[model samples]
Target chain A: MTRTRKPGISRRSTLALMGAGAVTFAAPWVARAQVKTIKIGMPTILSGRVAQLGTSSRNAVMLEVEKVNAAGGLAGRQIEMVIRDSKGQPQEAARIARELVNTDGCEMLLDGEASSGSFAVHEVARDLGVLCIHTCSEASSLTADPKQHIPNAFRCVRQGIHDSIVGASYAAGIAKTKGLKKWATCSPDYAYGRDTTGEFVLYLKKFAPDVEIISESWPKLFQPDYTEVVTKILQAKPQALYSCLWGGDLTSYIDQANIYAMFTQMEVFAVNMADYTALTVVKNLPKGIHSGDRYIKTFPPTPENAAWGDAYKAKYNEYPTNWSWQNATAVMFLNEAVKKANSTDGKKVAEALTGLTIKCPFGADGTVTMRADDHTLVGYAIGWGTTIPQEPYVPDVKAGDWKTIFELEAEWKKSKGYT
Target chain B: MDLDALASCLASPACLVTQTTSGLIIGMLLFLVAVGLTLIFGVLKVVNFSHGAFYMFGAYFAMTAYQLTGSFALAILAGAAGTAILGLIFERVFMSRVYGRDVLMQLLVCYAFVLIFDDVVRMIWGPEFKSMGMPAAFQVPPLFIAGGVVPPYYLLLIGVALAAAVVLGLGLARSRIGKVIRAAAQNPGMVSALGINTGLIYGGVFALGGMLAGLAGALAAPVRSLTPGMGFSVLIESFIVTVIGGMGSILGALIGALLIGLIRSFGSLGFPLFTEGLMYLFMVIVLVSRPTGLFGKEVA
Candidate 1:
């Protein structure tokens, strides 16, 4: 080979010289490029009955990552995500958080799971000093009181308290108009379920003083056996039922309760009955039942939401769940904060995130604001509507005033001693 | 103690009737699952950890069959037959290897199937929960029971499970092949020496167990929600039933299931928090007195 290349400065030596020159010139650029990338760690529930929660949130994050990367990445560096499955286990969630921070070198993290898992990650964030945005868990206590607040953590998901305010108001209004009382509940037996049910009932009592919670049943989450609960609710003979059962539990309850004609007698107010996935599984979703979407596209029906929904549908071949919007909103806040700070420093970005207002696709007012005090999202469109046989599950999606919610949240926060 | 509570219970005969009916219905469904577990343990000498997963497959299979044929009867047949064939294949391919091996080998095989079946479900059904769509022609409407309405579909589920229990109970005791099975369960070594082809008995019993599980799942699919981990939940309850009733005893499963069902049905009224705990309490009490479980084995 050397002899053949000797006539024309030896082909091997010529190629080697060229390669060496290229390496010499390109080495710095590659190293700089590697340094320019931002890494985010995500711990989520990626298995079991509520697997959809994590999967949807993951999809939403990927969608945002794509959008941001395509538009030249977060802070001029290419975006990278390190996702870990929590398996919906709280300890696993905490372990993954620590691993992502220590082993994976993730500068930022996202913890979007059920309350049990999310709370664990919140503790990790507090201890490890990693910036975290909770994308899904609606437990108000996670970010409510100042004494228990984690400065490193922020939540982009709608708070349970906010939902209660809107849910109770709508329920109270509906109850007043329909003259329905003697409410019962069938909630998942856990913190989220209990809190959501309690908050809704507590606020409902304040709104409609005459409401009586006649029967209450707490079925284990992901437990499909609702026969006993249905029978009890039927026996209680409530004129109306307010439930916090969501996702599969909600679907199971609806189907089981329908079998016993539980719906025929009671005016049902299920907090999360308007979800697309839940609705698809339900055979006979009565037209007049009051329902609300945690993140339904058709309800808002705005051009922005329509576009977002279409895009998400095109990507996933299904409707994006409420958690998807929540995580996407979270991604938006992250992107905006990182851009605003012009730094990937967790503390700086978090400071920028405090009280940041960003355009959201689903809100009625077209924007969502992050409150500085609790680091919770506000300005979310709030209301429940009567179901219809059309595109949007609920037609005339009743809208609520965010200002009123803001005021109530402030008072509640004050009560929590966060103010 | 609480006279007011007693009066309330007495006053609501409808509630009582509804609870009893539902309890029996649920107990019968649990019986279907637990009986399968008992049968498999009886003959195979292998604790099938994947039994719940097999039940889940039956529901999925029935769901698919119903979509294809649009006949509930055909769906039930499909669920049973499909699961039986699946069991046959699984036992032939995997369980056969571990037969005559240590308990650890058998347990490992079952666990491997559990993982495999779980993935198979996620692969086949995806992560979304499926509905077997309740139909209008489901025999009857919510039947008026005292003062409460008993869901019409519930009667169908109860009838199938009860019929299955009776047929299986009689088959295991009265039929010729059934006698061989009982013999094998009692003394597989003796049956093997007696030229009964114990392997065939194991396969048959395993297939039968799978069929019962499938039947329960298919019937439940229309009533209960179908999801990935449902098999796990039902399996937990089935385990409790088997442990309490005696692991390898079919009749014991029936009694155990009904006991748990009644507890769950009425326990919520007295102590909602302790409804689940009561099952364990019963298990602890029974096991304390009789370590081998109620119908597990005769004292040596």
Candidate 2:
């Protein structure tokens, strides 16, 4: 009775209606298939003591990606990031990297890990054959060592060797002026810490031969207590100290060292301390401590740099760290490469990235070059300065010369058989 | 067996003295964290895996309190009270159901809380390091002890921690509630049969343990930077302390914490590269030699 009463369509009409309904349902899928988006997977430490490293990196990347999208994206294709937390574990980083490429359909990889996790991601990128831009790791060998080099993986962040040469040159001058002959080192015990500290010391000794490292303490990365290290330094009675501890570790080290008047006794030259993360967090930040400019708005002393820093702070409500700038540079480089290649193919984009020079705010001379040989970033305001108690923490910024950095880096690579 | 290294570390008598003092300060702070963990395990017969999360919360809570009131003492109180309240709620709501369950079930519940607490902290504070500025009183110049410079705050930490230990030791030994807690730990069924509210006793003990951990966190806040997973390192150290001290023994916790602290400080001086491994090595030695721990009794 319902069939008789219902105003049912004829068989042909019903078929046409079903076809129309199917087309309507499939229309968005058709549009979605046509509008392609480039998916870049980021595996970074998003938890643990150095979670800020990941947070800032992700923030900067998102900011750049947002800009690219707002500017109509790369070749009219939107950029999407699939970010994963490695919890600072190397195996987890590898797993997430693989999963992002294999399972999540990510075409490119943005390795946001520190040294340990970054190595793992490097291998994964190699195995997966995805274009990977390392944005956070500063460990020299990740790019400098020919053995570990992958054609698809390039580092956009400052390398430890570059920073060491610049930092040592700057610190050597200060040490000579201050007559700081005796030296002690308290660096985190890891590849980045050990390698960077060693490189800095090597250069420092070369530049200032009178400097003697009487004491060396290699505290495990993220070691909560620094009492023993401080005591060791005091026992040595070094006139100066050098450390590669960054982020919260540096902040904690400074705070604990201050408690024992370590700063008063010895001039500290922590390469990672000039960043706002440590400077702003350090309570009663003792003035006159030397530090490599990690990421101060005023360090590059460029209007563009200051404007970018201001924009980041205004957007995130926090000062950007070295990681923020490095990741921003990475996304910028990636965007440029995509545009230059005119395709999202990993090989093509990677080829395009070779020796790519991008004019960005963080650069030393208004430009940073991706060194053709090592595939590592060559510029981006590498320098050291003394700390002040207030904003523009490291005033009278002294920028490093990239030419000298590159020359020394090449020598270093040759010595290490990495040329 | 590098004599040169040993000699180098021992060359400075003042440094040795300062290291010893620093070890004691570290030990006392660890005792504050471990004592609560051991107490909870001993009384509840459940490993409180979320203890570290509790410690993290304590630090964050103390930071907030310090920001609001600008009083260090009040910050410590706020941290302790906040964590205590959190522990009580966790015990009454979640832990109570898993009391007689399998150990795996109990661990799962506690571990879930750890993850939840970590995420909650990140959500509230954001994933960035936070510093609780040292109070003005503790900012005095370094104190010279045995020709070595020591922070005035280090002495204060030692003093407060020792006071806490003495009060806790006496409370557990002499007070009526302490007697009941000891009795309940030994035989909760018997305590229940004797008309004692075992549930209330368990909750109170858990809360008290959390309070101690919170106290440690609050005290440490001024010295160490705060992170969402900051408690993890402390938690691992506490576990090592508990394992070496015997999981259920208060006195054992004290000795174990001191041993670890001293080892860490001394290890850093002599074998800086292996300092972290040294702790685990010590734990292994302890476990192999004395499974029940330094003061632990064999549970029948």
Candidate 3:
């Protein structure tokens, strides 16, 4: 079987021989490859259940690349973004991260937005000595405790603990305003879910002191139903509700709640990433129904957000969403960092990023400050909700429509009291 | 209440409401994908592994239809019809050959279809995530529900699901064809002896299952948003629902859906820390004792 007919192989082998011979003869030309553009790798969840997020992120990054290249290029050379879909799987993320470095020769890695994907790529970046400026995934572990994995990996978004602190405090504040002192939580049953919930409970307890946790329910992530969970929450009769569920889980929760009128029953509902992705997916969710009335509106656009938002709308025929905006801002910051460093060296860029700040189009606080401590951003974290809309752009405007209720809140200040 | 606390509460109401709404939407999408799996397993005596693939195809089909005709309605109709056709083809060309085969073989074949279907999507869609817009008619703002903002589309979703349940239930209970399908489900050999075309009935049932999945994909596109692997998430949860509701029971699917839905909602609030474990916990409990489900009459 290995050598049935050498003559037949040689006759048919001429084509194969020619194929290899041609490539081999062209080897000198391939070796003359010049550095026309700096390649940056962005492995996102492009084609899976969370494919929308990844796609939106990639589009945002690509838009940044286009803007950068158009504006005299970066350092007299065009910046090229090599995007690979993680498919929201860690194994695939690791594999693709390696390929991006080995095959594509990407200097910097931007945006592995999902927690698992980011964690997977972090290890590969450490081995490759590649600078990974994360715009989204904030699993906490990625930034802290080098013993666990890569201490070199840095995230641009707020961590899991920060989210819990913000979400819980908001819920407690609602309870206080309503003269109620009870709180409950519903979160997905996973590491991110559990950690966020636990941290929220701790912080809420620390702040309120008097408010009680009436009940707690942990449903499995991506579980088909939320009805049973809803019943248990209503039975607890908490004054306010807290949820760490993001993405599709948030959408599922809202659908089930509408059926049982749970939305009407709860005094307050606090979702960590609610206005971020969930609101985008379930756009125009009963307007005034949003609890905060903060970051939900698609109008009254800021100057910074105007250009990107307009461009996104023109291309996708939809509003620019949270993940998309975050990703764009992340790439912009990364490009600025590279420009300031004037080199693609990972360590030099990391050094340049320390104490360096850039204004982001998506930020409400005018600028995003990259903290030197863990390389996490210290700038604005915007949260929005549904409100009574006054925007003329939207029609059939009910009494309650989504609006930007909160803007540029100082929620992530490093505390002197933590010790 | 302190003035500072009041101010903070007023400042961040969006966080409170978005969480609640997000959970609700997720549950609704799960029902669409899972209910069909429950039905196929309930009477067919085999887990429909290809259900997710059908769902993935439905979303893709909707995308194709939407591209052809820039109308959400046309896309939805095309999605349903195309999936139903695919289901018919699936039953006639592939599934018909597997009846009475070992459950393992049935599962393996279905699993293989998943690989094939996923690759097909990748080849066609080119590994890109595409979003489908909601119809202008359905983009209405939240109706006044006790002085709260709610997206009117959500109400439409609930209405559609409830109406489907009612129509399906009534048809199954009253229609002559329904009786025949039920009889065929109960005793295929006996129905065949009575001169019924069991093969055709099975194909029709599978097609009906496919239609449900396709409808689910259409309804979900607006809420879940479109992407390549969107169906897999639906598939996993639906499997849990089918297992919990008893393999082949529609009522079980409904009850199980509500159970899972509420569990998810409460889990976000109650045991928020372990919210991800609630469904698996329920699954373990159901499988350990009854092994059929809450509404399941028999354990396979």
- How many residue pairs clash (N, CA or C atoms closer than 3 angstroms) in each of the candidate models, in the order given? 1, 0, 87
- Could you tell me the interface RMSD of model 2? 1.6
Model 3, B6-86: lDDT tens per residue?
A: 233235444234334434555555666777787666557678888998787887788778878888878888888999999
Query: Which candidate comes out best when scored by DockQ?
Result: 1
Q: Pick the candidate with the highest TM-score.
A: 1
Q: Cα lDDT for residue B100, model 3? A: 81
Each prediction's whole-model lDDT (CA): 0.83, 0.87, 0.66
Clashing pairs in 2: none
lDDT of 2 by residue, A1-419 (tens): 35564566788889999997888687965555448787889998888767887888999999899999999887677888999999999999999999999999999899999888899999998888889999998888888888888889999888788888998999999889989999999898776788888989999999999999888988877777788788777877899999988778888887888888888888899888888888888877889988888889997899999999999999989989889999999988988887899876789989999999988998888888888887899878888888988988999778888778878987988898886
Model 3: per-residue lDDT, tens digit, A1-419? 48565545575678989987887677854432333677888888866566766777777777778888888566656778888877688898889888988999887788555887777787888788787777667676666544433434567775565555555566556557776677777888788888777877877776677878767677776654455566556545677677777666676666545544566666545443334345544533544333322222342245665666778768876554456766776767767877899865678778878767898754545676776665666554443343332431222211211121111112222231211
Q: Residue by residue across A270-295, what tens digits does model 1's lDDT show?
A: 87977778876776666677876676
Per-model TM-score (chain A alone): 0.91, 0.90, 0.79
Better of 2 and 3 by TM-score: 2
Candidate ranking (DockQ, best to worst): 1, 2, 3
Off by over 4 Å in 2: A1-41, A86-107, A120-130, A149-151, A335-349, B1-13, B280-291, B298-300
* Model 2 residue A30 lDDT score: 58
lDDT (Cα, tens digit) per residue for candidate 1, span B37-85: 9899878778888899878988999988988988888888888999999
